[model samples]
Target: MQKKTDFYFTYPPNLQELDLATMVSMYRDRGEPRKAAPGKYLACAVTHKLLKEAKWWFGLYYSQAAWDELLTKGSEGYPLTEAELNLLGLVLSSETPPHREYVEKNIGTLPKLAYLIVNDIKQFGFLQEDEHGYLRITPRGERALQGISRRIYQKRFTAEMLVVYHESEELHRDDDQRNDQATLF
Candidate 1:
């Protein structure tokens, strides 16, 4: 009835560390996604925001690159399908901000899975699509992305350093102590 895992468990990268407000503003400024069916637009908007930020962090300046990378990187946990990638591509590249018609024509029908991605990010304080479809990234998101990665890297590096340090230190353990142990034997 249960299973045991030998590997360590890790939490999903904190969503609170990304930049959400700027992302939402990018959507409004671009003026696209104005047309995905009513409730769907907001969810799309929030998902787009998080994806873009992740791409930026990953060194992808364009949404197309970001979408590809996001989907690839997220596959292990949050798998994104073709339809979702299409929607994200539209939102990320929204120059005139394509409405529902534009998205449908470009990406075909939207799927329900997109909502799960948005909701997952929101659970960690990424953003919530309002009734009007607006989104805002929480401060936690900014810190999580900007700060957590570096901190985690440092922590791992430090652990490794400590191992080396301890090993090196062991080499210097008092020779007299060794002699004493040998004599007892």
Candidate 2:
């Protein structure tokens, strides 16, 4: 039989900063290639879970341009089209509430722009939109940009939880074996 092992957070290496490319790489280790976007609902749920645990900053790395880029298009790594890049640039530099003219002059329509931004905030959690519809950085958002949190360092380690549960069960089995051995002796 294969040796059983505990799969919990045993390794304590310092977490490193990660970008979207690195995030895709991290997920790849677990079997998937890449998670696509328009993922607002999913991103919101996952990031909210992280935020609830105060781990949002640690668990994810983000770029202002990258996120807005994903919202406008689908992926971030590829070179953006002029319109896409322009929209991304506008969002990255804007503040909370954002400028109406800025978006219209650059992107367009509140609903359309909000749709993208809401999703970005959902995934990344917390965005600063200016009265003029400009998006600046929030403290939380800034932390993500800087790669200061460790939560993003690990792949979403589901196996660790399962391994821990199984390890406990195994310990019980070992205890039963010990009892049996003692009774035999």
Model 2 C-alpha lDDT per residue in residues 1-185, reported as the tens digit of each score: 12232211111123234444554444333211223344332232222321111111223422333233222222322212222223343444444445534444443223343354344553454455555555554554433332211122222212222222355578999999999999998
- Model 2 per-residue lDDT at 30: 25
Our tally of clashes for model 2 stands at 27
Q: If scored against the real structure, what TM-score would every candidate get?
A: 0.24, 0.22
The RMSD (Cα, Å) of candidate 1 is 21.1
Where's the lowest-lDDT run of ten residues in candidate 2? 49-58
User: Which lDDT value does model 1 have at 35?
Assistant: 32
- What digit string (tens of lDDT, one per residue) describes model 1 on residues 82-147? 333344444433454344433444433222223443455456453434565544445443333322
